[model samples]
Target: AKWREPKLDGRITEDLTINELEQYWNPLLFIDNILSETKETQWLMAQRNETGEVYLLERRRIKGVFLETLELNDFPLDVQDLTITVTSERPESEVDIIPDQNEMSAINVQTFVDQQEWKLHEHVEITKRIMKQEYSSSMKSHACLSVTCRAARRPGYFYWNVFLIMFMISSLSFATFAVSPDKAELRLRLSFTLILTSVTFKYVITQSLPKISYLTYMDKYVLMSLAILCIISVWHAIVTLLDPEHIATKYSKPANLFDLYGLQQHKSFLPPDTAVKSTNNTQNETDNFFKEHASLDNGFADNLLAFFLGSEQMEEADQSAESKTSTDNGNLSTSVGDQQNTTVPRLSNECSLDNKMACEEWKRVQIVEQHVFTSFVIIYVIAHAVFIFWLYFDASRRRREMRQKDKDYRDFLRRHQQWQQQSLRQRDMHAILRSSLHT
Candidate 1:
């Protein structure tokens, strides 16, 4: 019922005979309205096969034509029920029936058919797209958009920009290694700036995408990278601004009741396992090493003793300390516990008189500490550098990496510069401290 061919009718008397019927039937031909809209068109519509999906009633576009409109075919119709009405039929006279002899077919019938054909084609197109179901699926997924646009210049420039940003960031992060561990301000300044940079990046990137509840991989990657860089900056800030020795004391040192008693006697104990002392194999030497050095009856007074015992240099030094103690007096060792308990007090007059001596002793300790610190710092830098290089190389250089590297590098450079400054400042403090021994 969706489509129907326009029907035609004719009436003639039987007495008018076979010749007239032959003449009427001779001119009968279906109009091919779909393709030929001309009223005087030459082509005729004839069913190729009733069972076919479409028919080439005329030699034009009906075959293999991509129908943009809804395709219509194979609908049942009342072709058999068509009835002819006789206006008049008589034996004395012949009756002839026909409409506007110049045009015996429906008028403007093709126009109506064209509108229906377009609607059918449009419906078909819509239904097929809905069934295919491709583009609309984007509503719920976080899949990476695989862009297939043919814009060469646009994508080219975009790729270049991404590369450049990443290059800069990576350079920035890499610069952290060059920062010294001493300066506190450098890390602080750099960290604040990089955090702002990351915020700006987030804002910029978001402008190009729709707001989504679930994060795309790109979003997660950006966020994670920002977090990592923030942490890196924090670490640098801590190392640069804070005094490791002071912090270690605050956090790692166990509290003890006896600390109030000046049990350590103003001695700032270095970290454990950092030095070596000698084992006194002989009874005389063993008695001096523990008995002379230990303040409490407990073995802790000679904790440094246990550390340095493995080295020959420290053993020689121990011998010197013993000789020095022996010079104080033979009776200094008379009561081992009493001698160890007594803290050496600097004399008021000796403050000026022994200025050179105190400075010399401090200089010696500083040199030893410097040697230890420099050796360990070198080892730490080598190990850490290897790790960072591997991480950078192993990871993909997405736009995200570039941004990360930029922020991280800024912090890295700041920390490096700060640490260098801290080292210089430490040296200055040490010099000033030693010089005060004279004043």
Candidate 2:
């Protein structure tokens, strides 16, 4: 808008100066400033032949005046007050700092006629800056710090990715609830899952941000989310490692409710654990199960319970007196033994019978563990799938609704436009008829 058309010098084709101005003051010099000079330059932008397209030489000189407050820097300077006069790349130095250059060079550049003022919307992207510390020829600057910086627009998907990442982290947290406490793999799986979730979060978020040495706001948020999940996983692992009743005490509502009701009648799971009671209980239970076949001593119940929990110790006891006697009696009375053996059961047959029962017990244990892990995993998977699907469905529904609303709005606008056009035609027709009748 501040483009001035210079009159051509009669003999020199005055447009040469304008062409020069255009080249020197190209669009890249898009700064807001007054034309600090009234004198016109005689520089030529470019030469052209007949019916020529002109190209101008582009060069720009800008003087940036800023109040460099004392608080901005911590280092020493040659002068406290300074008014730096810059023309093109050369910035003229002042022996003593000055303000508002009254005049500079052979031509004065402080004021110009009929110039338009431009407003700056944003600051310039300074690729690099040079800071000088000395003014005198004899005195060298203490240091020159050249800084490099770049400008970037914020990513359009910033908030969208944030929501997605948070949703995934929260989903992973929910995933932890799907593990069973009884499964030994639960703790490891939880830790591994949580760790992987954290890693995924890091990977996803790192792509969205600059590589600042210090963590950004979004980084802190995502890291905090991961930490919370890790804590949940760790807490779950610890709880699962503990006794079931203890865990039940900590987590189960029924256990808590029962404890509240039985608060007065509290029975200890490990009351004193006296040696006598432990030993006697173990012996009695063993006698019932083994029928006096095995030898057992004190603390057997506790030891047995501990073993069941995870002691990895098993006691192989001797066969019963009846079993030994039956074996001996069979061999002693060969004839009678032969007749008895034909009628009586053999040891091999008994072993075979017991093997079947042991195998059944093993299968039962396996089935129990399988069902527990399977149920837990399935519950979590289903919950996760449901939640993810819900997020998808909700987003889809909103988008569909928005589209519908937009369609409706456009239809309304079209109808209103048609009505307005019709109304205008009718008014014009009435005016034309009135004019004709008057004429």
Candidate 3:
């Protein structure tokens, strides 16, 4: 007769043994979606020790697939729950499914396996359930054991592949804003190309996921990026279509004055747009002023000759000849006041046109370009700062959660050790009491 040991701690019932009641013993255990199976007849040893106790041990390996429900809302940062179920094919009367409590968190991950992309989360949980047979005619319930495993996907790889790509495309779009508005055609082409590239990137990212009904966080992010890029593209078109004449009129500043005479302390502040016109106008005025009154005064004649003929000797000779002519004419300026009133004002008015406002139109264009570029830079910087802040805090929160989980696991292990130590002490005490009672 085969006898079972009582469930009392420290009770010494040494006559327990298993007699080979039958030649073969089989247990019907079923694993769903098994990939491979092997059947080998192995010798089972039931050793009898001096105390008449028997021990039996067995080992086997079976590979199977467990379908899991994946929640990919956060994607690369998402966590998944995997379940492994073991059940007997026969009804409860024939066999009962039992859970091995000691095997909790006993998932054997190979040391050489690539764990970079995925890692175990916390530990495994074991549970038992009665699987009701609703449609079958037998109406028998099978006992089932389930093991729940949690795993988290590593996000660094996807950060480089997906999020990094999106960031680069966004930065490229921002770069287009700095492009000179004068190159309207080129700017438009660049904007269009960037928009197309964003679309292509979105397509590539989506290809990695299934055609699910709901959008994941990655989907929302990609959409937001595309929308921002589209806005930038529209702004590009706006800049391209800006009216040149209107911009010139609106942004052009007062023209700078060119002083050929030391009277006004000639400041050469001419703008870029009016440089050519101012140069031509100044040359013409100098020529006309000298031609009309070349014989007015010896000093003035010398200065004029010097201005035109780049020679000190020629100017001196001209000054001497003019002085002799004035003496011969006997009209050596009746009054200084008359010379000033008749020559200075008329020459000033005739020779000088408004040299300050030469290239008002082109200057305005430049002003508009600077304003647009500045505004774009401000917007880009603000948006970039916000994006970086969000990502930084998000990563920090995830790290905190991971740390909390580790701490909790450590506490659980500490409590389990305490419980095990207490049970061991109780067992030792009970054995001592029973041994004394038997003596």
Best by TM-score: 3
Off by over 4 Å in 3: 1-29, 32-60, 88-105, 109-112, 127-143, 245-403
Residue pairs with colliding backbones in model 2 are: 8-14, 9-14, 23-57, 23-58, 24-59, 36-109
Model 2, 1-439: lDDT tens digits are 1122233222243335663455443222222123354433333344332334333433344444333323112111011222222212223232211221122112122342212221111111112223342554654322111111111222225446674666566456655545544453675676676678667767876764445565544455456566656655665665544434344345323234335434323323221112113544433333343333123332332233222221221231112222334444333233222322332232222222212333343345446546654664565467557644753464334334444544664565567678878977998899899899999
- The per-model lDDT (C-alpha) reads 0.36, 0.39, 0.57
Tens digits of per-residue lDDT for model 3 on 1-439? 1112223123342442334412334345565434445553433333343345543333345444556667776666776677777666678876666654333354555651558878765555678888866767998988777877666777888788888888788778767756665566677788788789989888887888888888775776677678777777776677655644334333432111112233123223233344334555545454455444444655554443333332323655465556566363234333222333344333333322222232454556668777866786687678767755755566345545655775676687678778878977998899899899999
TM-score on alpha carbons, each prediction: 0.27, 0.31, 0.58
Could you give candidate 1's per-residue lDDT for residues 1-439 as a string of tens digits?
0111222222222234334323332222221113333333233332322223322122222222111221111011000111111122111123222232221122232343434212111000000000111344433321121111010011333234433453345335434535444344675566567667766776886676556565543454456556555656666654533443343334332212114334354334432112011111222333555455444422242233322222223454355446555344344343333332221111111222212333343344446445644654464456446534633454222323434544564565567678878977998898899899878
Candidate with more favorable, higher TM-score: 1 or 2: 2
lDDT, candidate 2, equals: 0.39
What's the candidate order when arranged by decreasing lDDT? 3, 2, 1
Give the residue spans of candidate 2 off by over 4 A.
1-154, 200-210, 245-439
